[model samples]
Target: QRGECCSIDHSAKLAIPIMVAKSDGAINQLCQPGKKRRRAITRGQDEESQKASSSRRVTHSSVRSDGGEESFKWILSKRQFTDDATKQVIDGRHCIWSRRRQRIGEFDEFWTKSGKSWEDLTTVKDPETVISNFIAQQISVHATNANSNACRTAVGMLFRIQGFHEERINGFALKQIMKKTSCNYKEEEKGRTNLQVRNPSEAHTGKS
Candidate 1:
């Protein structure tokens, strides 16, 4: 009777270790290859569970969730300066000069032809004041069309004088013109096309 009880107690201890081993095996299959080798071994393990866990592990490593790299590339490719803004940078000085010259010419014609001496006009200390006053009066007649076109032309001339690439200048101008005229549709279509052209891989991934 004592021998029978001893045999049963030994079997009970071995059964506990077997259950522990099974639990370790279940956890091991979820771990990577290097990690799996470190886990405890087990008997009576479920083959299906091991296969499922292995598949999941492979999927996790193979699939990328973050689109950050593609997004950054897209943004960089889409970055561009508008024509008006570029024109402002390039031709601002010339535009100012032209406006001042036109004002001086008008002043000379008006005062000199009316019997005032050229010396008297030249003696005026503040040319800016005279130009400002004259511009205020002309603002009503030709402010919109004249100012905009003159500024654009000045910008174009500046770009040419500075030896900027014509293609780049035209592209910048085109973007500005489209933005100004289309407002919604052109911008949206441009954004879509830019994304398509820049990120063909991303589009393919989405389609699949």
Candidate 2:
């Protein structure tokens, strides 16, 4: 009877006799008058319920998402440092930040010794502070050397890189840098005009 039931596809509807015959063992055991059969049925139901509950708990607690769970497990397994090592790294000052400062200082000292055009150290004494100020100065100098309009454009680019998409540098600050750099606005304008005049015919042809 069990073999016949196993052979039949579940999708195909079977007659009552066939269903009864297939499940005869389970039905007889369950319906027997003795308390043993009753106990067996109850135990089977309890076991099934426990299995379902266990599965639910596991699924609920486990990290889900196709590749995410596997990736997380991989990362966790690859970590070499124990809890103590992690605590030491976190609590100690001899880490990445200190190493970065040392590297920057070495570079700055080398440039100073070589008499190369380095950032002014008189204004910013701290290594970290000097790093930021130096970058700002370099950018300002580049902007000034490029052209009169370059300063404003450079400031816009700086703001975008710093994650401020909408903010712009004030006109006064830009004017101050331009003045300090001694970039001659009038000379640049005159040069542009001279170039335009020299190639007026070529410019007109290209435009058309």
Candidate 3:
């Protein structure tokens, strides 16, 4: 061991730097370039996604299936109306109406197909014209004349609560649809009555 030059192990120096780096928390920074910038980028993506989710303005809709009424809540945006008085029309507005008579989705389609909704029925400047279109659309779906009339009545009630009067007891288009349906019903009834009278034997035997 005299000429062995003290046998100093060079490998031990490599292990010392690694240990120091770990203690100082610089190993991560050294092995990964731009570690701080990468973390900042990740934060940026998360913030961007958060902002997008926050800015999404979709309206929420929920309806019960139990053939019972459900509460409707709409938070009035302060800036949506020009004055507090107008805003009062929407703040805490609640309505409990029959929702099981007809599918609200079909009714919603009736509005969406006509460029409106139950919520926006009174918001439009020309509800008469819009409703005329809506009624016609309903009839086009082959909805029974009575059902079409009922929908118009429902919208009129919604309007009244929003401080609007019925444009007319029955709008022009609605009156026409009702009249046409009424005439058809009368004719059908008359035919059935005549048939029943012609076959009294069949009626007595319950075979008609």
Candidate 4:
């Protein structure tokens, strides 16, 4: 038995505790035999190797601020929001129209506060309904119907100028909603006008 070991030697190896240094700089004593200790060491080495490989792979693409790899979804979201052509168009509008710039700012603030991504328009279920509800919600916040209509128009223009297709913003549904809103505004105005005209006549008759 050239390299053979007796039962006593094997028992001695099993009785000893092996100290293993964790990746976090902590020492963990493993009460394992030779075979178990070897397997544990191999597993730890494999994990380190995988992590190093991941780091190397990330160097070929954009890195996040936190030193992590940029995910495809994150990259796509950034591109959609910061596209060069879209930025130029928006900048031009801002320079030419102060009111437009303000309205666009409001829309941007609303969108950012909602915590939604542009991708959600296409990816979410019943996007048309979702978009309609969002538009309605925005319009409801204004004190006057005219201001509400202006808010709706601003949101639509912003979506269009950002290169969103008709389908993306549910154009047909939006048109119908706008038509309804306009009719409602006219009816309210007419009622107020009639009341103003009638009030003076009644006052004159009472005086007579």
Candidate 5:
């Protein structure tokens, strides 16, 4: 037990609190809304109207400085929704999209809310490509220097949490490819770091 004693390291435990893990968009990252976006809790508002709406979702609107401006900026549902009114269907005892995200088949659609309009992420035939491209673009500017694998996995998890899954969106394929990419990139970065440490003179001259 050299330099080791039972001090009850909480990190070593199998389970950790959501806040402790800083998962699902961190504790406060989601608080900041985009210029035209507002995060409103679905209370008091026509929460019942959602069930009757063809969209089958709550809408968040944009506001102006001088007055109140409204537009369907985003779908504020605990579940996922598509522009396709047909997507709003009841599956057995639950909304097709609920606590469990399901497969929307090969032609699933994801409506990404940007500023004024919704970006249909599923315009392409393949959802996996869309997921990979989006993650690749995001990791380059992420707060943490995340690799594609982590970024892709995080986005995929978010979609799943939003009641979307399988071919309905990117599935295991993107994760597997990015996982291998992350491993290879980590190995390369480690080799470069070790080379610099082993030969400081070579580090400056760009020689290994």
Candidate 6:
């Protein structure tokens, strides 16, 4: 036993400072190298931090999913202002009217391809529910995220000026979608700026 190595008690806390003194030979004998000790402490800290971060991420994701579903439902519940009296309200505004016509053509074409008529929207003044969903879906999926907010805003204005109920176009539910679009636009622009900074030539050439 006199020549044997001392047994290490791995479970002991090592946070206390080692004191070199006449009374502390046992502490000095059990001490590990500073780098290894620091690394073990850091590893434990990192694991704990990662677990907390993962929990936060899950909660955030759940909240986001629920909010998105509610917003989508609200947008889907909206009805288009297709009354005969209100139909021509935006006709004098050439650009808005043209956009509306374009949207209608696109919506009808989409349904026609699926063996459905645009007139199938006759239920519940439902001209809006499908069209609103279609516009949001198209813009969100097809339009560049950088222009997401602008595209939604432009189409949303068409609903507003055409004399739709405020909640039909500018309600809190619709605003949620717009808020998401604006956030995406900002994120996209930020990423683009970062990419350009990292590789100006590649960005200019549109290579990545």
Over 62-173, each residue of candidate 2 has an lDDT whose tens digit, in order, gives 4222222232222223355455654453245344423332333333443355564322422222333323334345555553444333323422322332333342333445
Q: What tens digits encode model 6's per-residue C-alpha lDDT throughout 1-208?
A: 5334232332232323333353377656566566678999999999999999999987765554443333222333444534443435434455654334443444444445667642343332433454456557767566665344443454454345434665655556556666676687788889889889999999888878
Q: What is the Cα-based TM-score of model 4?
A: 0.43
lDDT of each: 0.47, 0.45, 0.53, 0.54, 0.43, 0.53
| TM-score to native of every candidate shown | 0.20, 0.19, 0.43, 0.43, 0.34, 0.42
Worst 10 residues of 1 by lDDT: 64-73
Better of 1 and 6 by lDDT: 6
Local accuracy of candidate 4 as per-residue lDDT tens digits, 78-178? 45745565455546655434444444445445554688654553344444455466557766774356655555555555445445666766667876876
Runs with alpha carbons beyond 4 Å of true place in candidate 3: 1-96, 99-105, 115-120, 200-208
What alpha-carbon RMSD in Å does predicted model 6 have with respect to the real structure? 17.0
Local lDDT at 198 for model 1: 82
Q: Give the higher-TM-score candidate: 5 or 6.
A: 6
RMSD of each: 24.6, 24.4, 18.3, 22.5, 25.7, 17.0
TM-score of 3: 0.43
Candidate 4 achieves a global lDDT of: 0.54
- Tens-place lDDT per residue, model 3, 1-208, is 6445334445566779889878778757675778777998999999999887766622122332111111111212312444464435434333424332233334455666656554574465655565566666777767776666666664554344444456543467656766776676679678777768989777566575
For candidate 6, what is the total of clashing residue pairs?
1
Candidate 4 Cα errors over 4 Å, as ranges: 1-88, 91-96, 117-131, 167-170, 201-208
Which whole-number lDDT from 0 to 100 does residue 189 have in model 6? 88
Where model 6 places Cα greater than 4 Å from the true spot, the runs are 1-91, 111-122, 125-132, 139-141, 145-163
